[model samples]
Target: MSSAGGPAIGTITTEVPARLDRLPWSRWHWMIVVGLGTVWILDGLEVTVVGNIASRLSESGSGLPISDSQVTGLGAALYVAGACSGALVFGWLTDRFGRKKLFLITLAVYLASTAMTALSFSAWWFFLFRFLTGFGIGGEYAAINSAIDELIPSKYRGRVDLIINGSYWLGAMGGALLSVLALDTGIFPENIGWRLTFALGVVLGLVILLVRRHVPESPRWMFIHGQSDGANAIVEGAEKEIEEETGAPLPKAGRAITIEQRRSISFVEIGRTLFRAYPKRATLGFSLFIGQAFLYNAITFGFSSILVKFFGVSSGTTGYFFAVIAFGNFLGPLLLGRLFDTVGRKKMISGTYILSGLLLFVTAWLFDQGWLNATTMTVCWCVVLFFASAGASSAYLTVSEIFPMETRAMAIALFYALGTAAGGISGPLIFSGLTSSGVVSDAVVAFCIGAALMVAAGVVAVLFAVDAEGKSLEDIARPLSQRTKPTGRPAGPPSAPAV
Candidate 1:
């Protein structure tokens, strides 16, 4: 094996990806899940806490002079803007650098910015750090998703990815409950509670950073970047460790692939690979992302307002309702994720999206008719989101896997930024305006729009979703650095199967 800093520029053939995919589930895989996947939970906690605390922050003696509208509207917008900007910048960097390096740096950024947010004494300071905090979390989406897809076995990839993405709701659940306690006047003073919430995020981030340190970089990344010896060492070590842990002989790895290794891929090549080389896939990615983004933003941004205004549910108790809905979101992926792997991606992705959209249409009709109360409305959202969350989580999985390995991180970043922008910006603006209008019909229109978009995306899924369940990443989309075998044509899309 070569040294860690050995040459990173040559063609080499290796079965690193095959070896990784063929391994039996083991303790080491769990370590990767805990180390890498937990970041989503932190993100959920960050976004949720800010939202729940917005009203408190706008109050007298809360220390900041920000209004409720400023905290919820402008601050939220800046945070999302920061996240989109960060994803694009760090995503490109993650593709350029190794996953381990970028993931660590992104997490550090989250910790530092969030920690500073806890100390903010002014509105500008608070808003600036919120954006920076989002910046760090945005980078995590690209780096972590790429690493997780590359590292996880193909058989378990669909469920694992969905669950990891879905874990954001788990953090949302935590944040919802945490805010209830944080905002309690008996437990904490108004000014102190909000600051402590941000501090807790920093504490959680620090722990995640510690666990993440032990996780290794993607070996597939190493081999393609001309670190073949290091790649082989890592794979071989994993194979040996899994065998010992599982107490069984391991299966032989599948076929080896040759590559024309390089240190980096240019944005021009990345663009061509996504648009020109795989235009259908680019469309699929956009459809899935936009659909899910709008629906989530519509419901989440308007959820509390709807309860308070239409149903007369008190603002103080909205957290309890949100926690229930968040739990439903997490459960969707946990219960339905295995089906995506077993039933196949096309059928499952489309089914979930379509099902959720149909359910939302019914909910909208019921809301417009004034036949539902707060409890029933919450139940309706819980049901609708049960399917929507699973479909939404699959969007990330689809984009990450369908692109070439060289563009994996950037693809995840681009789709995320686009989806988040579309949904995060438009969903909130449209839904908030509708729900706050004190007209039930207006809010119903917003819900219908979200539902219609979701249904349309599902229709697209039925037409274009890739049948990627249990397939090798190399088989789904061949790496750009890969070399064709003697007498074989140059690499294109995998001819194995289609949706």
Candidate 2:
């Protein structure tokens, strides 16, 4: 066996990963998708409400005395900063503990923070709660993306991930509509209405938490952690259920890789793995994430203000515009996600990015010429974001799939932290300042900057995008515990370790 104090570091061979990858798509899989995937919707809901309510929050009696810029600019930045912090901290914990455990805990954190945000009577309290809410969402990203990649079949991974991540817009749509109703003076008072909007998030989070409780721990994770029996039980149960549902014989499972089970991996090792072993991919992840982060944050957080300042749209009416934009973002992934797997990741990613950037540039020109009113401006946003949303969703799919399983969560966290810090935190602030200036030229400059970033990221994707479609995770990146490193390993079935 092994020494007690040294940690149980020994090789164990298992087919859990292969078994999971080979299973047919069934209702059981859909359950996992819906239960675990709803976190994105909650995030979308949170962000959309904040953006839509920025104008209302600055009113004389809206509880918080913050200016419109503070709500959309500083407030958005703080939320992103908190998300960055949470991703790093919780990402490490997820890899150390388990996906199911961290996801549950993270959602609870979100529920508590969001509920308390509704009770805030001051700027500091509201800002603190918003940060906390962001912390929960950031943690959810790491845990959820890791678990989804581990459990979903390789063939369907790309589409599934895109659709799930894109569902954030579904929540955005809901928030846009809800805020419209909530902000109406006839439906609710100014002070009470905004508070009620946040409180509704608590109710949604509670329902999602109940659904998440039933989602089992990742079997691949269990086996890696040395619980082979537990892993086998989970996979077997899934196979049986799928087979019975389909009324067909299941195919033989793929080969299994042998791994030396380690109780925990250190931060230093994780860093080395990212920077040293996968430097090119690290660059790719950063490029994809930052580009999308800047474009999305700038537009989403500041869209309402642009409507008010440039288009003379009322705060209450901005939700209808946002709802239309949200629908476009949601449909991008729904309509185009299959291409990432079928047509290949590189082409689709690059095409979407570049096309979206061009559209943004054209829209900027139109806005500068003063040829577009509120309706036309929103349509332009919808078109640009439709393409950008799908491309951004692919960014997450790329980072999650290209790295080794051991460092999966941390890798995602690092890119998200870096990208969000670089783009997300600054995008809103910059755009808010530009939009608040009420100068079309300044807004045009901001749009140009976002467009340039997206185009540059597209070029990077063409240069470094990994050809990972329809391939198993093991094929893409070998486990760190393997006897052979990824570069030296040949294309063949994995062999069992000597007992």
Candidate 3:
């Protein structure tokens, strides 16, 4: 292959996919997980800190003159908007260029923007950087999810994807506890405490950048883009390393596939693939994303205000309650993730979404009756999120795997941007209005809205969820580049119309 402006383009028969899917679990795989998956922690930290610090930032001496409602409502909406925009631009670039390059570039963008946020002198300055931070994170979603799904073994893919996506809550837990300390005037001055939280996010991002440097480009991507030699070398290296680690030779790989290699897929092809070639899967992707995005945005962005206004909890003490629910969120995916593989994707995904939604409906009724304190409310959220979190993480898993190889990143970007825009942008705005009003009826309305969406998404899952567990991605959705046979048949049409 020539090292020029782009990868050399030509037809190539390769077994890169089968080789990758057959490897045993080893330390090398763990390295990839740690490097790629840890970014969600930073995202969780960014979101949770902003929510938890809204009240602090609105105080008399906090330097920025933002109000609580603006921070939670307008600021949160802008962040989601930035994320939606970033996902589209970067998702296309990731598919065209490569996963490693885009992931690294996106992370650097996040680090710089977050660092600037720490030095903001006004509310507009704070809001601008928040949007930029979301932009970087949004790109990470497209690049990272496609890369991880492409790289992980098929047997471990379902559970691993769930746990990695769910790791966001671990960062949420940290941010919640960190906010308690930062908001305390006894430890940090009012003006400096919130700024320190943003600064710390930058620091953690820098550490992750160092580790992410070593993660490889997806071998699946390389061969399809006309770098078959590079793809073969990577698979061979992995096989050697795994064999040494396990003290045994590996099994023979499955059949090779013939691919008419290309530089990139077009937006028109991507749209047809999503809407025409696989409409049912597209519906599943949108439903799962919209449901999770709205539910998470409503609760995550508005929970602090709900505690302070409705239950009379102190601003500084709200983090303790938030932390309990964040733990529940993380535990949900970690504990139940394996079940997605064991019991199967269709059953597990639908079950979690429906169960969580019903639980939230009950919690909303109790809150409407004024029969709960801050502690009881937090407990209710903990139980509701225990299932919702797993269901939410699976949304990412579903989008990444159900699409063709060339369109994986863009597919993830489209579903995330459109679905999140529908739910995420409006969720915080509505919840912020309701919770800030301090009216029990208004808050209950917000809860019911979120609960209803989850139930609706669960019903969609029952109708459309793919049975993707333990199946090779090629089997689920053939790459656009793949040919019908080695010699007998002509290469299939180079578009989704052929599918």
- Candidate 2 to native Cα RMSD, angstroms: 2.6
Which ranges in model 2 have alpha carbons more than 4 Å from their true place? 2-9, 484-499
Per-residue CA lDDT of model 2 for 377-477, tens digit only, reads: 98999999999999999999999989888888888888999998899999998989998999999999999999999999999988888989999898898
Ten-residue region with minimum lDDT total, candidate 3: 490-499
| Predicted structure 3: lDDT | 0.91
The local lDDT score (0 to 100) that residue 455 gets in candidate 1 is 94
- List all candidate RMSDs to the true structure: 4.4, 2.6, 3.5
Q: Candidate 1, overall lDDT?
A: 0.87
lDDT of 1 by residue, 196-244 (tens): 9889998899999999999989998888886777777788888889888
Per-residue lDDT for 1-499 in model 3, tens only? 3447876777666767777888888988998999999999999999999999999989989998889999999999999998999999999999999999999999999999999998988889988988999999999999999999999999999999999999999999999999999999999999999889989999999999999998989999998887777877778888889999999999877456788788888899999999999999999999999999999987899999999998899999899999999999999999999999889999999999999999999999999998999999999999999999999999999999999999999999999999999999999999999889989999999999999999999999999999999998999998888885323233223541110
Point out the higher-scoring one by TM-score: 1 or 3: 3
- Cα error of candidate 2 at position 18, Å: 1.5
Model 2's lDDT to the true fold?
0.89
TM-score of each: 0.94, 0.96, 0.96
